[model samples]
Target: MDDKKVKILLGKRIKQLRQSFNFTQFVLGEKIDINQRQVAQIESGHSFPSLSTLVKLAKVYNCEIKDLFNYNHLEKEEKVKENIINIISNLDKKDAQLLYAIVKVIREK
Candidate 1:
């Protein structure tokens, strides 16, 4: 892919990862010590992240660097995860605790 396309692809992958982790760009930028505007630029493909930034992103997303470039259908999965987080968050503490336990059990398997 051309450099522009590559940058956009990276942005999309980063966005998907961010959504899956329920992180706003501002929050992610804070973790990586960059301004949220820079994060927005990166996510919009208006700028490319440096290697160090990429490393930080991979660490924050808990994925291999390669995975960032390989994202496709994962966008749907990320959206689902985002929705689940939003729904679970609105539940009462007792219900949220039960949901968490169920998720943990499912994840452990």
Candidate 2:
């Protein structure tokens, strides 16, 4: 992906993680020792966090720094579908059956 897209995706992933942890931007900023405006900038993709900030964020979120970059769910729907298809195609028969069952359960929900 392009730099802008990567930044946007990373920002979204950070926001998702923050929300999952029940943290507002102000709370997250306090944990990371930044200001709320800075946190807002990061979440809005207008500013990228420094490596130090990332380390602080990982600590605050109780996750590895790499986990903060797991932004595949922020990809375009078509790309996501293609990735899922590729993964499914590589699965063994038994795994495929299990996956199908899981998907069925999810769909029912």
Candidate 3:
């Protein structure tokens, strides 16, 4: 998969996991020292997170680093992809393109 796809998938997983743990954006963001808006941005797949931030998130969620990016079941993968697409579909074209560009860069690396 491409980087954009990765970002979106990561975001979807993060959001779902966060919700599963009954965490609001403010609650999760506080642990990482970011505002709720930032958390929302990350969960919405509008922005990528730094490594340290990702570590903190994984720690807070009680999940391994690999868990944050993994989709083992085909149904789960499709659901997350659908969620990511839904989130991005509402954004303006520029924002969507920016996300896609990030994914492209990641894919190249």
Candidate number achieving the greatest TM-score relative to the actual structure: 2
User: Can you list the residue pairs that collide in candidate 1?
Assistant: none
> Runs in model 2 with CA error above 4 Å?
76-109
TM-score winner between candidates 1 and 3: 3
Q: What would the per-residue lDDT of candidate 2 be over residues 24-46, giving only the tens digit for each residue?
A: 99999999999999998988888
Decide which is better by TM-score, 1 or 2.
2
TM-score to true structure, per model:
0.64, 0.69, 0.65
lDDT of each: 0.85, 0.90, 0.85
lDDT of 3 by residue, 17-52 (tens): 888899899998998888899888888778889999
Q: Which ten residues in a row have the lowest lDDT in candidate 2?
A: 71-80
* C-alpha lDDT (0 to 100) for residue 11 of candidate 3: 84
- Residue pairs clashing, model 3: 3-103, 4-103
Task: Give candidate 2's TM-score.
Answer: 0.69
For candidate 3, the per-residue lDDT at 84 reads 96
Q: TM-score-based ranking, best first?
A: 2, 3, 1
User: Cα RMSD for candidate 1?
Assistant: 9.7
Give the C-alpha miss distance for residue 108 in model 2, angstroms: 18
lDDT of 2 at 107: 100
